[model samples]
Target: MELSNLTGFLVHRTDVKMTNFFTKILKQYEVTPEQWGILLVLDTERATSQKELAEAIDRDQTTVVRMIYSLEKKEIVRRIQNEADKRSHNLFLSDKGMSLKTKLMPIVKAAHDHVTKYLSDDEIQQLHEILSKLYATVKDE
Candidate 1:
């Protein structure tokens, strides 16, 4: 069987292409896909510890810490000393980050639409379900 026919290869190839696509779009906004993931999490979850943010984004704590530092440097994210845990901090998007998110929501939606233009609603739903199932099956291992 050809390498392209392998499930792993196809998934990875698609991921790389999608990341590249997003990278180009996000570059103008001064955000990387990884940082964008953190922003989205903080936006929805509100104040959360770095550990929680890492878990929510399926990334390691150290990596999340580094990302948070970068976002902080960009003035897009702020770390407040956690009242309950002085050693840790809760993450929040700054005013600038909120404005950026507001601007990005539409473009991100358009990007999603562009990528899935060829897929029907039902196909898209099925794809989501399949990917979620696969992710769940392997995520704990």
Candidate 2:
């Protein structure tokens, strides 16, 4: 196989492994990977509409809505009607969600560190850039 093909195969394998590891770790917090993604995004962006979250996370609206409902039921998130746009509801992390984010951030960081341990700092930087470029390419399609 060509180098590119080999890299693609490794990427796929690594993604599966990473997902499994993350799922196990996040389970302790009673969160799935999808829920974690939403939490992380809300942590950084603060109050945002579900539509915005869906676009930012590159997930379908239906999937996002389902995740939102689950998180809301867990008291990890709350939906507030948009004052200006009655048709839209903005999502915000609840006190519980904020607490969870604070508690779980170190675990997330450690997982990331473990996964990238084999790469040198420069290689890690390059890898990020390459991945960003790849994402942009596909996002434009």
Candidate 3:
């Protein structure tokens, strides 16, 4: 088989293309893809701890801390002392972050829709399920 026809290579190419597309879009907001992932998780799960955010986003603790610091500096997120654990801090979206989410949600949804436009509803569901299973298997390994 030709190297160019390998499924893994093709998938990686597609991944890079998609990443570039999203990165371009996110650049307008001055955020990176990883930061966007963190914001998305935080939006969905409010008042999450740094450790929890790291796990939720499948990122290392140090990386999450750095992103959190950047977001804090931007005034988009705040780190409040965790009452239950004085050593830990809970993450919260600042008013600025909430406003950014509100402004960017439609753009995010549009990008999602555009990417999945070729798939039927059933196909989309199946794709999500299959990807979820694949993730679970890899995570368990």
Candidate 4:
């Protein structure tokens, strides 16, 4: 059987393509897709726990932790002790992170808009719903 005939192969290829596109867009910002994802989420929330960050980005805890650490070293994100749970740390965007997010948001939106430019609003919604369903199917297993 041809590898290209497999749905998983197509999905993976598309994922790689999108990631590469975003990598180029984010190159100067020095943030990867994962880092940007977490930064975006942190920007929305006043403070979020590491576990929450992992869940929000649909990533494993270890991966999220490592990315957060990198962001921390760069002074983009900092972990403050959770007041309620001293053992846990809540994530927050530093002034630097917020500033970067502001700059990155427009470029990110433009890049995404460019990718979906040919799709109608309805088509975009339908595609998103279909992808979410596919993700749930495998993720729930």
Best by lDDT: 4
Per residue, candidate 4 scores C-alpha lDDT tens digits across 21-106 of 99989988899988899888996358898898889999999898889899999999989998888989988999999999999999
Q: What's each prediction's clash count?
A: 0, 0, 0, 0
Q: Any residue pairs clashing in model 4, and if so which?
A: none
TM-score each candidate.
0.94, 0.89, 0.88, 0.94
Per-residue CA lDDT of model 2 for 1-141, tens digit only, reads 676678667778878998999999899789998888888889534679998999988899999999999999999999999999999998999989999999999999998899899999999999999988877877767
**Clash count in backbone of candidate 4:** 0
**Which pairs of residues collide in candidate 2?**
none
Q: 1 or 3, which is superior by TM-score?
A: 1
Tens digits of per-residue lDDT, candidate 3, 90-122, equal: 998888888888888899889989988999999
Worst 10 residues of 3 by lDDT: 37-46
| Per-residue lDDT of 77 in model 2 | 94
* Model 4 stretches astray by more than 4 angstroms: none
Mark the regions of model 2 whose C-alpha exceeds 4 Å error after superposition: 2-7
The predictions' CA RMSDs to the true structure, in order, are 1.5, 2.2, 2.0, 1.4
Give all candidates' CA lDDT scores: 0.89, 0.88, 0.86, 0.91
Error of 1 at 38 (Å): 1.3
